[model samples]
Target: ARWSPSGDRIAFVSNSGEGSEIYVYWNTSNTTSKLTQLENGPSSISWSPDGKHIAFTMKVNAKAPVIASMPAKPKGAKWAKPPRITDRLKHEADGAGYLKPGFNHIFVISSEGGTPRQITTGNFNHGGNISWSSDSKNLVYSGNRNENWEYDFRNSELYSSNINTKEITALTDRNGPDYASKVSPDGKHIAYLGYEDKVQTYQLTQLQLMKSNGENKKVLSNKLDRSINTAIWASDSKGMYISFDDKGKTKIAFIDLAGNISDIVENVGGTTLGRPYASGSFSVSNSGKIAYTYSRPDRPADIAMVTKKNKKPIVITAVNDDLINYRTMGEMEEVWYKSSVDGRDIQGWIVYPPNYDSNKKYPLLVENHGGPILNYGNRFSTEIQLYAAAGYIVFYPNPRGSTSYGEEFGNLLYNNYPGEDYNDVMDGVDTLLKRGVTSEDKLYVTGGSAGGIMTAWIIGKNSRFEAAVVAKPVMNWISKTLVADNYYGYANSRYPGQPWENFENYWKFSPISLVGNVETPTMVMVGMNDLRTPPSEAKQLYHALKLRKIETVLVEIPEASHGIASRPSNLITKVAHTLAWFEKFK
Candidate 1:
């Protein structure tokens, strides 16, 4: 939902079985009105400063590719459905399967309600979060309009489009992503986030500022090491409110024009229920008031508000009170340790069993977070709580490759993943053991995706864990790099060149390469219809363990995607399965 410039009206979209449609509500009258009959809902809906119109991005479908086929069916005969054809490079996605031959374009409609007009024309997907000029006569957006956009997917340029003339002007021309434009209310400046393509495993996006006419570009947050995720201009345009990950927590702060950043609040995420991944959003009002998602370790998310007058945030919603408040929540503690590989500091979070006793011994469940670049912070997580409630101490570490530790640290896995990250995690585990939080005999491990890769690598490196569950892992990098949904995307960034070109290097980092020495009882699980890591990747581990006469179980969840915990049922299934598997060994 988005509030209009007038603050008296708000606009939002809703799905009514058919598709998403636009709706507007007037705060003064307490009345709502339907604005669109759209089958595919609009996104990035923004109201003009004058509140005379609203602009949004909507998808425009194109004709699918047609080819020569067999003869036509008989007059009244029923035949099979025609095969779907596609020639696009990145055709399918994880949750969203197959490609819809369409492009997102900007549209505008009057505030009183009327037909919407398309202002941009292209076969490219114009991103959302579009910014408009103070007069609302122009709009700035990001898109990969280059001819080779299919192959050069990483490169995107910010472009300004005139509402009346519909003239498009390119504002950025670098070989990296330049997106999320925010036109200052004064119409003098435009703030965006991007970074030049260094062609590495990970790169931090810097906050950039430029004139409205696209002149005098400069990096505003150069001195800051962490990647800024969101930015909003102050009412007076003196500075901007920005959000970034520091250590393992997401923080909201105000960054001035001179690059001085001051903290506003911490613990900015809890929207992701399945995992403790950093996720949340906030918006600033014209009066310098801010509204955002308030998060806690015991709750999912609640509506919170803050004003410049009062820096203290007032959480206005207790959406999970009925359920979360009634349940016993485990205690969460943040721990830091020195990586054994190097003396570099590493961060991790531990969830002790509910009503814990320091005198009692409990099994240790090492849950590795995915991304290898994404950090798991102290956020409310269903899976983490379940594991902790199941009577085990849970540890999820943000290793060397995790973000929020500067770009150098995140890119530490560049061409050398499963390298120092393995040691970083082990160091954390060993630290816990030394503190008497857990014992070696009751150690268990599990993770999905990159986390799964790490779990496999950890077990292969040492038989320390009594049981292991590896979910949706890329066992063989060579096979995974070529078969996964993002087949063409990971080549040069992950390792060097194509998988075949650097066969030995790819195989060296593959978890399957070390599976020969595995002795821990393992459970291999994956979504049957997963496209990211694919079920075959899990099958590789299951097959290898079987061939070696190792104890293993393959759990293929039907009709699920790479995100096995996307559905609430799936989330419960995953946690239950992991707990069940670990129980046997415990």
Candidate 2:
């Protein structure tokens, strides 16, 4: 709770009934005054070098859901009034059933309470890492402003703008995404991560440096082909620190202006909870002191701080200390196996149930990750832990398209996903069975979104699983292409041609095509407002199962999105419902 610059006062966020407000606490006067009174929450407050104003992001009220015009009162003389037309979009939302109109944008306000001025405007959503230039006259951020913003997930470019006039200028124009840009301390250079674009997938993101005005761009880590997760400027601005994954381990490295790459630290833990994937985040102070979240196999993620002189790190957050007495947690162990389809080494993790006895057989739950492109690494995941706590052995693998394995390994399933990756998952399950960690009769499968599609596909191809829970799955490519959030991207990248041109390929990979072979009791769940992997996808699979008289049930989480378990209450319900479904089969 220390103030920056002169340190006369500490600036922090204060919560009230309406929302969170920024406040500055004067140490001498022992008084607090509000800096912002935004209706929505304010965060990432950065003080100006002159300490006159603070820059932060705030959510502004936007357009409300539109309601279709209702037919004039049915010419009925007895009707007192015509029924009001409620918004369909509101009714379709999860949890809240409808959304309160809001859009996130960057804003600046005085350190003392006053009217906050909006600095940027557009339909495109913008909020993530934000930083101020050395002169404190400009703001830098990353967001997508393409014409087709809804379907352009990979087109985010770094942008900078003058705070006074709000005149924006693009810093990088590339086919692939560029994000996490930070202006160097001296204000001459900026560092960020970028990669070449491939259809439907992303490559290993490398650290790049460019002048503040967007000239002389060059990749700093050309020799280090691994993806650079994040980059931060050093105190002197002569060099910058970066984090990347080597194999499955997270390493912190530094690169000087001359492009000399040196590993500053390695084995910095942070992937806790589920599998041991390379995941960690670090923030450096102006004094070169680094604070990071660190984790180990036996523990969850915790904050730690380190300095150059004192290489030894100190844990700041004690989340694990409170859970040490709990006996229901599982122990995650990294596992490696050769793919049956090919000799490629597949990496995954096995979570053994607490109080597990080798003599007794246990049920196994194969969980698929959402992003076929995103990796399921050794990061802390509450969803996986709850399953392990329920006496179920959980297996989460990176499959073929998962990141951190290199560009080639990640893009292996590019246009051919659910093909080789499917074999890789099944082979991993077989390997686990051979290890005697799971029984065939007690095996179950479940995943949401991309993983959901895989779960449905698995049951369609094989009846090995006793039961399956497919959450927010895609059943029809044609329908998905038309209705999904990123409809254009999803359809264009997965299929070589349009639906009419490549109907056979779409059907060949779709789970609905093989629904007739599904005999296992399946439970399908979807978020009512999920634009990505819309609920209609799950309904198709459920209706198909019902038509064939297969044991099936469809559960819709109202007011939720593809990320249905984002809320704590919803997470509990999701876990409870999934466990109940598996228990009924057991």
**Residue-wise lDDT of candidate 1 within 1-586, one digit each (tens)?**
8888878999998885478988899999999998987747789898888888888999899988999777978999999888999988888888888878888899888877889989999888787578889998998999988998889898999999999999999999999999989998799999999999999999999999999999999999998999999999998988899999989888889988888888888868889889999999888877888888888887798989886567788998988899877888999999999988879989999999999999988999999999988989989999999999999999999998899989999999999988989999999999999999888898999999999999999999999999999999999999998888799989889899998799999999999999999999999999988999999999999999999999999999989999999999999899999999998887
Error of 1 at 396 (Å): 1.1
lDDT of 2 by residue, 1-586 (tens): 3274567878888785467988889988899877766788887777776677787878677755455655566665465554443332222333333445555688888766689888878877665677778898998888777777655666788889798989999998888888878888899998888776766554778888899999999998887767888888898999888888765567777788877877766656654433344667787888888888775655667888877667677888888677765645678888999999888999888788887788987899999876777767555667777888899988988788877778778777755757888999999999989988777888999998889989998998899998999999999887887676555565556668777788888778888999999998999999888877888899999999999999999999888888788777888888899999999988
lDDT of every predicted structure (CA atoms): 0.91, 0.79
Models 1 onward score TM values of 0.97, 0.84
Q: Which ten-residue region of model 2 has the weakest summed lDDT?
A: 86-95
Pick by lDDT: which candidate is best?
A: 1
Error of 1 at 149 (Å): 1.6
Q: Could you give me the TM-score of model 2 versus the true structure? A: 0.84
